[model samples]
Target: MRYMAAIVLAAALLSGCQGADKAGVNGSSPSSQPEVSPTAMSATPSAPASSSMEEPLLYIEQLRIIGGGQLVQVKSNIDIDQKSLEQALKNSLQTSDPETEFRYTLEWESPRFVQIRLHLDENSVWSGTFNLDEAVTVDGRKYASTEQPYRNTVVIRAGDGEGSLLFQGVTSGTRRVVPAWNTGWIKPVQTRESVAPSYLFYGQEKHHLVHALTGEALEIPVFAQEKDAYGNDYGYHEMYSDRFYEDFTYMISGNKTLYRVDLKGFTSKKLHVFNKPVYGMSSSPDSKRIAVLTAHDEFIGPGADLTVLDQQGKILHSRENAAFISHSDGFLFVYSLAWEDDSHLILPADRDEHNPLGQIRYNTGNGASSVMQDERITDPLKQDLKEHERQPHNDLLLSGLKWSPDNRFAAFKSGTGAIQVYDTQERTFTFVSAGTLLGWMPDGTLAWADIKDLVYTF
Candidate 1:
């Protein structure tokens, strides 16, 4: 699943574009352009002339921000006199030099408001935010324009000492805003582990961990045993729980053992190991219990086993399944299991006439199990699982299902590409949007990547 996510992320970054168009990084002239969203356009579709016109007149009207703070769309009044508005625009428009100019293109045709695209290009085009609301009269108001140079050198350091970094280009203005770790990064608590390094297939390099936000290097303690089977040193691949940086458990697969380590005391405890090679694991919310799903070929066996163990390596529960044992099959069967709470594990069970993907709620408190169904069956709409939803790959989609930190809501991508949030209390499935699941914000807000792969928060 991690590898799959890496591939998707790579493709998204390569194709990510700003605003409505995948225009060139340096702003292009507004002659021929792609159509913008209706919300971003004015009522008229024909673009006003840019070359011969003395001034580009734009009627100001209702203005609203969209795409977080990245877009501003406005409706221009259609009844205004074109010549008078053009003259007013001429007075307001200014350029620094021949290489830089303010360009405009008209968009949309509707009963009310005309849409326009405005760009200011120096080396790159910039869009600005405006709060103008009043109708234009001849007394022109002077607005100050600032030009910022693109700086090639921008250094960012970890302030809280840990987090993830997203590289971004300047969206607006000349201020060459290179994304830095100091802003828009999530800082987790620092650990003894050095940030993991990017790996190359055939090399003997010392790997380091990078902060999730700051991109700073971090070094994690992988117990006293740090070398692999061939006595080669390698970095660890960690699996963190929902608690994330605040409090969680992590396990390193190298050295054929699982060791639980703390960032504060640097204490190490060996959890478990299959006599043969083991592949993947998932930790419970409280970090007291861990489910280790082993590889199928690790031993000559007809069925694979899912082993639940305490932090001290005490076996609590184990079950057999023909499907659970193999990672080579491209799916982790254990992904179907979601922790309903610290004391309850929700595992998929057999479906019946009423419940489609039946669930078995296993009580970790007493090693008991019970059947659980989607309470929505009582609704008058009465929806059942569709054919495509029952596919084996659909179980993998469950891996995207993220319950809110408080367990109030569960967000997952439906087979149809729409993200749905299941309200545990209300017993209802509400359509959030058509997007890929990212994760929930610390404040419990849901975030996702839309059809275009742009991240959005709700």
Candidate 2:
């Protein structure tokens, strides 16, 4: 229930960090966040670093937040003793400890490169360059580019000792994201042949080898890969059809589910096979249950059958052909799970023959179904969405939804790029335009990604 509230705090707490130049939010918590104008923010710098004396906390580690083509800002320890590292961050994050003179190392990720940051204390702004040595070797060559000089000059402010490392890049920039700890982050994609879309990163949190792109399916860490309650490996452990692509188009049921996987060393038992072909599906938030749509059929339109199951693959309940016999709104059937709630499922219905408009929603735990939005308006936004790209969501797929860890919110963008919150609980709308953005901050404030020049929109 407090899912939305948590993000609000995160956004506000970090808004004063370097990249939040357009934000004017300031508050200790979300409920009291105050609004500031663009003009007001332009007049000041991020809040001067704080001076807490306790051991610095790490807010971000491992993963870097990539936006457009560059790293925005590293989110790290939001609360830190600002006085500890004043001189060490002059060049990089690694520095000799002021008191013990011991080694301190840190790493960073970007859209195009990987870097290491070293700091000795909390206060020092970066020195003129990235390192003290005159030159560094690359590929056994003492290469130096005058145009792209090595910059060790790093800066830090209050509570940023544990910040997430951010890098510089543009969305279309030619630079590529290189991996640092080869074993920790990236791994050889098991597909054998790599081209066009080549490479896989161990999604530590999701427990899969997720493709960086929007469309491909990543391998789920199952059985044999499960090393422990924690420390599991995510790689090709068993024999799965290399020729088949996981086009998981439906969210019928389960916290997480796959019809089948072949893991090695670890044994598994088959619970239930589909009575028919599997189609769309959704799973509960707890990951204990599952719901799936049956195989596709070419009627006047596409129709589906719904199936429910448990983690052990045991059939709980089955519903066949539960969807309408229309495909005009093909996008509505994009997924069967609500974004916000794991306890619900979305079923698509034809708005009309052309499939331009469709109805979609989920069956909540209350034994009641909720319509995402009535079929009273047009789908409005349209573009060439490749089968894999899912963001810049369609309203039908997101409306009347719920979140598990409260990671995402149900918001809508109109033709003009204005986004409004469709609060599922209040059933009311709060609009944010180019003028204002309302998202959750680490400290529970209304935070948002403020865009300047509109080079692209989806």
Question: What tens digits encode model 1's per-residue C-alpha lDDT throughout 291-329?
Answer: 654544544332344567887878888755512322344
Model 2 ranges off by over 4 Å: 1-269, 275-277, 296-301, 324-334, 338-344, 351-410, 413-458
lDDT of 1 at 310: 85
- Score residue 125 of candidate 1 by CA lDDT: 21
Off by over 4 Å in 1: 1-236, 241-248, 265-267, 276-287, 295-304, 322-343, 348-355, 364-367, 377-436, 439-444, 449-458
Cα error, candidate 1, residue 288 (Å): 3.5
Candidate 2 TM-score, C-alpha based: 0.30
Tens-digit lDDT string for candidate 2 (117-232): 22223332111112212222221222222322222222112112221111111111122222211122322222323322223322333323423222244444434332221111
In model 2, what lDDT does residue 197 have?
29
Task: Give residue 43's lDDT in candidate 1 (0 to 100).
Answer: 36
